[model samples]
Target chain A: MLESYIEQLQRVETLGELNDQVVALRDTLDVEHVVYHSVNSTGEQYAALTYSPEWVQRYLDEDYTRIDPVVQACYRRFHPIDWKRLDWTNKNVRNFHGEAIDSGIGNQGFSVPIRGPSGQFALFTVSGNASDDKWASYTQEHVRDLLLVSHFVNQKALELERGTDQVQTVSLSPRETDALTMLAMSYNRAQAADSLSISEHTLRVYIESARFKLTAMNTTHAVARALSQGLLII
Target chain B: MLRYIYADDLHRFPRLARSMFVDRAKQFHDRLRWDVTLRDDGTERDDYDDANPLYVIWEDTTGGHGGSMRFLPTTGDTMVNDHFLHLTDGVEIKSPFIWECTRFCLAPGAPAQVSAALMLGGMELGLNNHLSHSVGVFDARMVRIYARLGWGPTILGTAGQGRDATSVGLWAFEPELRPRLLSRAGITDEMSRHWYDRSFGALTPTAKPALSA
Candidate 1:
């Protein structure tokens, strides 16, 4: 069932379709809610959630992210976090939790934090009303599936945001390729130059030209782009 | 020196154990800002620590943690299997020949060689135990560190992107790679062997003599 939902998710093209799919996914999983919230590096926020429009609007109008323990905690985490583990000692936090529950946001939650290129931060969450033991068993049984779905959903969201489903290809000269590969292998400029039998100045030229071709911000960015785009095997 | 201490024996080196956990809190919670639980005593520990996992520790001159890493066999509960399966495409890494390594931490003022030395200790653990590979999940920032150590893992899969990218990788333990690791750690083969001998007894005659002094 999860696999079919992921298949349907992959076929979704527009953000609206993605939102509908999220709702359908929540129903299929028999959960109260499933949410995918992304905040890009440019500070643009996007979300596909099963929450009611009124509640979502109220959440935004009240700027709840400033006080949402889930958001605050997930921002610093790189793994799935059980809601029970969060600190709710602060009065404001307690009130926020109370309000969330009152708004039918469920009493149990699991959030997975994802960080993408250029400071893109996103959270994938599942929430439902359940006893603590039941919630623990549910999360344990479905953690892997949730994790897989989260990343793929986020990847699709990023792809749509870029307005391109196609992979971008950039060509590089042999020397440029060699330079990036050496750098990817953690070789310093001097060592790369010595290994390639080229002067350090010449290696720098190759790297600069490659960086320009890839339109990367820096050497590290260039290498990362090259690797991600399949331009460099290493 | 590299000491392979299990939880059962951790009490024997109380100072080293305490310092190791304290440094873990400093690195994972304070420095990295990871959402890890910090005890009131300021130590970062989790369920895995209770599993009696083995720890490879680099004891500094003052008998404190210089650098350390935790290892648990893939056959048991591991960080990769429990938390980061998304990076592995939901495939659990369970094998007798592969162990999981995590919680890599370094003291704030540790020397540059400490990281490499820790890697050397990991290699020693794998080779001594007849394990073929060690699996780990690390962020992109660690890529250069692994490469500089002359032993990079074969990336199984990666998630996210750029600086925040996290990957699950498998590193093969080949006898041929020992010398490069030794040079990178700046430790003589004899010294490495001595440390290994301290943890486990001297290498058997059937085992490769390269690590034997």
Candidate 2:
């Protein structure tokens, strides 16, 4: 099933195609739901999933992001994290969960956190109804494949973003290329810090410095420019 | 030992945030379908980080921030109280003594003792702040983790799905439970099974209220 998901990922060459393919993958997965979401280097994002429009809108309108433990925790790490490992011990977060379940998004989920040059990030998650034993076994079975697909999709999406871009820019330093590539590769600050053998503070300085040179507002935007402007390769 | 770093002090420590996949962290992007990057100027600022206490646990020798947690004292501006309006419902919340714990994280690949250190740090920070009782909504699965650390169910709490779709419960790690915990340190899991099989639990130590100016 995941092999076919990868096949679909490979066939898609455009962001629109990827979006449609993502939805198709969800339908194919035939579990309950599948979602591919991204915060691109431009900070413009795309979310293609099977979540009810009501839940999606309510979540956005209510700004549940700040209170969401899964989103909050995933942002802080580099690995593809399960929704279960997150801390959900707050009252509002619980309310958010109740609302999500009511929307038919299910309780069991696996999220693949992805990164692209210029701070591009995307999380592809599949949520469904299953026993703990079953879900654990399922995730264990497919974790590696999903991780690869996540990065592949994000890379393609970045390339897609580049194809549609109207902007242009100069070359990036090797360190800058490495930095954006790490961010592109979904290296969270700590892992990215270690990968670079630099302090996270210094990494931020490097990132912000890159942002300044690129005339970008933030790291995501910086990454977007790097990709769209051909400053960094995926 | 625990070294607390404010988000601002993310400058001094350097390792935690920098080592993090910069764009992937909460400030840049969230893993869910939704992206919550700051719109005002593309900065990430939750309510608690500014007004409530935000702490990052650091290794004193290496200065690596191994874990972090956010604390919101029971107050009007706090999200644990204000934002979570639906859950509180008609329940009574005795003000000024409770704290809402949020975003507790362990630095990836830290030593096993790190969580224990974080607990000690949290208690000390709470005691010094004049807070007495503490409340945390927990994922039902990790009830064992909290139970092992020192918290216990004070209430069943509101019926709700957890952040992860797991069952959840409300718990309290009150100061009054300290002696019973320490005196029973060597107790077997059988004896400790007052409610569940969790091995770790915090015995709330003596309450030391902060002196008023």
Candidate 3:
């Protein structure tokens, strides 16, 4: 079911369409609410959530982000967090939680943080009213699926923000890829040359040319770049 | 091969450990340009290394560091709790089932599989110790690498931007994923198991007791 949603997400071209898909996802997953909120590096904020407009406006007017433990905790963490694990001990936080509950935001929440290129930060969250044990089990069973969704949503968001549909790719020749792959596998020049049925000098030429194509400083840098760019699988 | 060496045990592999630290200095301080302290000995050492953290290192054929990562239980003072709390919105992650992995470094000419091997070693540590997750703070470039390895972490939050963007992520331990990681590292199951058992076999419940009755 989530896989289908990820497929739909990939085709969504506009933020409005993404919001509709998120709403549909909330219903499909039987969650009370789903929220995708992003704050780009330049501090531009966008949100597609199930919360009421009045509540959303109130949150911004009152600057609840300053007090919301979920936002605060999620902002700092690199792992999915259960609302129960967050610190709500402070008076301000307690009041914020109470207000959120009163606004039909539910008593339980789980959030996944997303970090995209250019310092884009986003949170994909699900909240609902449930028993502690029920919520725990729910999150446990669905964490992986939700994580995949969070990242995909963020990727789409970044793509839309950048207004570019084409993914940038660098093409390396077959021999170049083999040379870098060999180097990445920790094969020395002689060994790589032997395995590739080429002379050591020829292998060096391939590596140096590959390095130039990758704009790398050396063999190590070229291998690192190739791997990071998903150019060489190994 | 993966060698799990604690700080106290580092003396047993003096040259390998020294090379590991030197490579760390080169990667973090020189190449990445992270704000790290480099010692007069041309090595990078930090407060966490003094905490007796376990180091998972891949040794090359020459018996030097190929790639390495540092692990310390989150229950103790760790890099995330002590220095990176702001990234976590001030919440300190302290769990017996979760450890903090940091300072992942590779030698200048190390092969790419070294990274995957180091990750495999991390998974082995989690499985052997019954840990559920490992957390780390990494940069944008590492995100791509992790994704490529099919072991991307669930990011908790991020700071900075562009080339400097840093994020904290938690990696869950799924025993079923071991085979895929093994293949990625180009390591056979037998060798992986041997390395793991060599490091932790005695601690297992099935292992024979040192002082037999």
Candidate 4:
């Protein structure tokens, strides 16, 4: 069963074993491809995929990463996105799309954008060549499984690369915590500032400082981390 | 009658869910030419559909698909966070009380009243679950419809060039529109009460007043 694959992934000791699990996951989900690519905080990279070797080579030869809308779009997101919703405008992107489709890469794709400790960003993608209707049902049917599998993969990879004891607890200043709490409670900058009796500019400073301390991508991310870590209470 | 279908329960309603896909194919692919994939069986589905989304489905008396809307926790993967953040001026709306709604579909030949009912049911589902905001990417036409129904949502992004310009935004659960929209759609009080009464038969029914006006 697919659940067993996740259990195997947890005990995987080497990259090879981890990759085999990913392929097994792809098969279990009945999708054409499954890919996980990560760029760690230190800019070190690792990728596992089911793409053809020639396509991978061509992608590298043309440096498609620079023009990949999926990558660009996912970098700014904290959610999983459907490929159809992505903007594929411009001649180069269209050509790349055509090439990818021709290379037997599935016509339908979905990617989940993940963020981990120390500003790490990673993506887990599932793709297939089903009709829009079938793919919709397929994605709807397996999204939960995919999300669970993805986080498991990312956690295992992180453990392998940087052992498990590296957890760092982030602490924010009193003012920073106050600012984050207000933001988490759905207060706008001006409203939060007014409640704190600080100028908007001062509130901005507090938020920025908290963001730095937490290494969050944005204020929302900062608020999320603070709430999750019990650094800020509602 | 509207029913809630969580991811775990979806498998038990395969026929019902597949009907929604078929209806979506007709609406998005054949009618709107939205470049979506259509299965040989004439159903339409996408990757986001797999993410254990909460589904609010309005079914006809004959058990056919009527209208449906999908909900995802904003803390997880959502269309607004992934592709439409520009609508929020680059701000991410991440809150446990916020959910993203997408893939709203109404089967062709459904009555006009189905639209208002779908909106009311979707928002009521959010309110009942303690969700504050329901956000998603929507075309400009929906802006007019929402405004007319007194459910004016905040526009997060500006509409861009082209005939099919789309934007993202959120609809808060306040201003309770169930009664107002139902009346506007010419639905009688008896019909309205029937929906609420039937919903109780579904899983985890909330208080009727929360879904009522």
DockQ comparisons of all candidates to the true complex: 0.02, 0.03, 0.03, 0.02
Q: Is the docking of candidate 2 incorrect, acceptable, medium or high quality?
A: incorrect
- Comparing 3 and 4 on DockQ, the stronger one: 3
Best by DockQ: 3
Model 1 / residue A23 / CA error / Å:
1.1
Off by over 4 Å in 4: A1-234, B158-163, B185-213
- Can you write out model 2's per-residue Cα lDDT over A98-172, one digit (the tens) per residue? 777777887777776553433456777888877777777787766645554555566566657777453334445
Clashes of 4: 18
- What TM-score would you give candidate 2 relative to the actual structure? 0.41
Give the lDDT of residue B83 in candidate 3: 79
lDDT of 1 by residue, B114-148 (tens): 88899999898877555657878776578778888
Query: On residues B1-213, what C-alpha lDDT tens digit does candidate 3 reach at each position?
Result: 899887777999999999999999998888877888999999999987875678999999999999999987664467886778676544456444567899988899888899899999999888755566787877757987987886877665688876567787778788998998999999999899898657543222111112312
- Which of 3 and 4 is ahead in lDDT? 3
**For model 2 chain A, the run of ten residues with the poorest summed lDDT:** A73-82
Candidate 1 vs candidate 4: which has greater DockQ?
1
lDDT (Cα, tens digit) per residue for candidate 4, span A32-119? 9989998887899888999999999999999998998788767624446667666676778877877887787867888887656545
Off by over 4 Å in 2: A27-30, A164-234, B1-213
Cα lDDT tens digits for candidate 1, A1-234: 765676587677889988888789787777899999998879998999988788899888999989887877666234356777666667787777777777788888888776554457789999998877788789887765676567667767877898865653567766678889999999999999899886564456457546645545358877987898788876
lDDT for residue B100 in candidate 4, whole number 0-100: 80
CAPRI category for model 1:
incorrect
Model 1 CA RMSD to the hidden true structure, in angstroms? 17.7
